[model samples]
Target: MTAYNKEEIIHQLESHQLWIDTLGKEGNKLGFDEVDFCNIDIDLIKYPLDQAYLTACTFDGMNLYGKDMHSSLICSSTFITTNLENADFYKADVSYVDFTNANVKNARYAKSDCSEAIFIKADLTNAKLISCSLYLTDFREATLKNVDVSSSSFKGVLLKGAKLSGIKGLEDAFIKSINIGTPEIPILIEGEEAVQWIINNCSTDEQI
Candidate 1:
């Protein structure tokens, strides 16, 4: 695991900003491989974090709207109360990330590995999670309205208190098991039964 001091990280961020300004003509694009950014202030890091390795980073209360993070390795990261609206995370490795209370509306996460992630109270309205791995992910109290999760694996996912109105593509997803209802008395459904339960209980007339 590589480590960078605050000044070094800021310098890299400046270079990356220059690269973004010059459209990849002058400065080199920033790419952190196996870097541990724990406790580091990443507010200076520029947008479009493409192809960077950000495993186990913490991004609390940062405004990261419309950032392109495609193919980035951001596994085990924490994004509490962060703004990720319209962010693109296509093919990113986001496994075990904590997104508690984050604003993740309209985020694109196609083909991402989001297994075992926590999205408690996060607003994921209109988000695209197509063809992703969501095994054991916890969406407790998350607002998933109009979200598309087609062709995803939902084995052992938790949906307690999650609002799933107008959510799409559950029929196409592979739902092996899911936990719903309160934690004290959790209700576990499996196979086609879980699919039907989600559709019947969570959907409304305005479904998409």
Candidate 2:
């Protein structure tokens, strides 16, 4: 496990305060739309980014293990290849965020609105997404082994080429046009029982 550098992170965030100050108007004109937050721990409860209106941020290779970010208002951020094991994102409005290739094992995303978010090739083993609003979310080629999506709304979600083995709570969730296998087969399941039926019948391909 990596260590969390609190002071250094605070310094860096403070250094980027000017960008936050000019985010909406001047920052956009100056092309300062992204923030690099690699390899740090973020305690959003103390220093929040809820109203930052930040876009296209990067969090590659960061250590965010077990960090609580309930009700945060981050959007369109990228977390590629980051360590997010056991992180809590309950009720966070994290729409359109990219979590590609990130380690999200055992992460809590209950009641969060992750609409249109990208999770391509992400490791979501054992993650809890209970009651999450996952409308139009993309999970292409991602690993979903042991993931719990109970009561989560996955309307219009994309699951093409994704590994859906061992996932829980598809018995009571909305679904439409979610691919379960290769595009050649074009598996489109509807409702909870159909999802379970596909899972039981389909043979998994290479896990992402």
Q: Can you write out model 2's per-residue Cα lDDT over 1-208, one digit (the tens) per residue?
A: 2233667556545544454566644322111146565644565334434334446667677776776666666677788888889888888877989999999989888999999888989988889999999887888877887888888887667777677777778776665546555435555666765576547743555543
TM-score per model over all chains: 0.82, 0.70
Candidate 1 has its poorest 10 consecutive residues by lDDT at: 199-208
Evaluate residue 11 in candidate 2 and report its C-alpha lDDT on the 0 to 100 scale.
Answer: 57
- The candidate scoring highest on lDDT is 1
- Tell me how candidate 2 scores on lDDT: 0.70
Evaluate residue 40 in candidate 2 and report its C-alpha lDDT on the 0 to 100 scale: 44
TM-score of 1: 0.82
How many steric overlaps does candidate 1 have? 0
